[model samples]
Target: MGIAGRQNGVTGGMILHRTVVLVGMMGCGKSAVGRSLAARLGVQLLDSDAEIERAANATISEIFARDGEPFFRDREAEVIARLLSGPPCILSTGGGAFLAERNRQAIHDKGVAVWLDASVDLLWERVKHKDTRPLLRTDNPRKTLEEIFATRVPVYQLADLRAETLPEYSIEETTDRVIEVLLTRPDVLEKT
Candidate 1:
């Protein structure tokens, strides 16, 4: 059952006033933490990347290969907008989703962005074994990852709330930290 089953089951009935958007660089555990958080809150967990892939009937890498990044980014923005218009839920977006000003504005207007902060080394440790990450398919993936990390850190800082992930924390612990951050902003999430 884990933390989700252990948490007060009342979370399912609690009112979510706005979407909780998880924004961060790749390997920051946004997807893992988002899933745990949604289970703990008993709300829908939406992943913009997964939604885009489902809508396009292709993997993100395929979408990028055939349509290019500009097209994929456009589709990403559309997916984020469509999802945000729905009921409040937990949204785990792609690492680059927050890089666009338009997406940032949409998230700010309809949701609360939570930046999951992890050290670059920690991020590398988690992602080094993953081959599915489209953006890391480079001759020097580590340097590429570092470059992306440096560029995205500033933008991620613009999120409404922040949660830190340590090497020792489990996914549920990270989700709990995110919940603590959300609790500080009743406009986004409230205890019922």
Candidate 2:
């Protein structure tokens, strides 16, 4: 029993009828919430970033330093497209994944993108202690993060649906919110 059991007018385990692609800035809990969402749905969570790392045998920061952002982004697009063509599951993408029209088009074609909305303050708080963020290695990370947020929010707004991530909520609570939002689109999620 999961979302299907909890949602009104529904019965049985959750049936994820289409791929749910989680898109948002780094540290917004896409991976964390995807884990919970997948568990509730009885499916696997595929993280595009992890998939890329596995394929390349290198961490994202390593790839960024070796092949640069452009090459890494190209690989990201390929991985996203390939994953979306697979079975229905939860897919968590990188912070910048949805910025590309090609990736956006691929997601629109085979899956639905769910933007995990978190405020700049929340994102900064979550990421400040993590040195793994290559994009934030600038002279001033907070300022850089704010700049990136400003540039990407408009593109993220194009997601098919959005679920908020608040500082007051636990990962499970956030996952539930995502489930509630997904429940609104029967084509993407349902009870079977």
Candidate 3:
């Protein structure tokens, strides 16, 4: 169906009470947009990575350094599952979380998954020199980011809805666009 038709159908009240999950690369503004969207929708905003860090009682980099990526991902999935069991809320997942089939299934079953799309240049511009991202600590951060983007874009595309975010767009605009899209997907609005 066309975007307009889908929007009309969803807003017609067939479904409600489902959560919204934002999945994208690290620099794609999921956290920023999710926070705004959640505030506007009157729901809590949960960042999966942050939760994982809390659960681990350490920073993400510390977790990565101490346990490695596989271990971190396992913790991330567990945290995500726990978060999904709560009331409807806006969730912002780490860039690599949705790349795992189990994690993807968990999110798909619990909420509306929206992929925040942005170009590599835009992503680099946003993330460059950001020391917080554990994965970006390499000799060639740009090359690392590029490789990550190439590998994960397809996985991100599996989201139920795709919202393109421009480099110039403000967080409010991105959040609004996401809300507009979410208000359009009946399947997304459906309660589990």
Candidate 4:
């Protein structure tokens, strides 16, 4: 579904007090858009993957290869929990984080979840050259992305809000769109 249609469910004048959590596939501009959005909103920004990497003393790729995906997911959940336990802020979660029900519930209970929706073509165009993604290290990166996109799109749809991250737009524009969503649908930002 398109972003405008996705936003129809959020209406009425409700205030939002929780953090804004960005959830989507890799290369959907969560980190960049989130940082800009947080700055514009005058809130702090935290990247869960970066936090996990810092805590593990290694890159996400290294962590995955060394400890395995299960271990990495466990650590990711822990880091996300820790980050969410703190004050309201903008959090950019790992692409696969929201695939887990525990993490999804945590985000739902703790913040306003915004799914940065992007088409498979857009995602591929943005991420095809990035070697930092462990999941993309396959013989065919396009196929890998397509697989992940198919699986994760439905999962991301469960988010409280949805915003399109067009390649033509700047990060500031994406952030502005998110800000507009938050301001228009404050109910999604309510603390639980």
RMSD of each: 3.6, 3.8, 6.3, 7.5
Candidate 4 whole-model C-alpha lDDT, 0 to 1:
0.80
The candidates, ranked best first by TM-score, are: 1, 2, 3, 4
Full-model lDDT, candidate 2 = 0.89
Per-residue lDDT of model 2, residues 96-192, tens digit only: 8899999999999899999999999999999999998888999999999999999999999999999999999999999989999998998998856
Task: For model 3, name the residue pairs that clash.
Answer: none
Q: How well is each residue in 1-192 modelled by candidate 1, as lDDT tens digits?
A: 344533322364455689899999889998899889888887788889899999999999899999999999999999999999987888988888899999999999999999999999999999989998878999999999999999999999999899998999999899889988988998887777
* Candidate that scores best on TM-score: 1
Off by over 4 Å in 4: 1-16, 188-192
In candidate 4 the C-alpha lDDT for residue 7 amounts to 34
lDDT by residue (tens digit), candidate 3, 21-91: 89889889988898787666656788888888777899888898999988998888998888888877788
For candidate 2, report its TM-score: 0.89
CA error at residue 94 for candidate 1, angstroms:
1.0
lDDT of each: 0.88, 0.89, 0.81, 0.80
List candidate 2 segments past 4 Å from native: 1-12
Worst 10 residues of 2 by lDDT: 4-13
lDDT of 4 by residue, 1-192 (tens): 333422322223322367789989988998888777665554678899899999889999889889999999999999988888886778888788999999999888887789898899988988887797878999998998999888889989999888888878889888778877776665544212
- Total clashing residue pairs per candidate? 0, 0, 0, 0
The TM-score values for the models, in the order shown, are: 0.90, 0.89, 0.84, 0.84
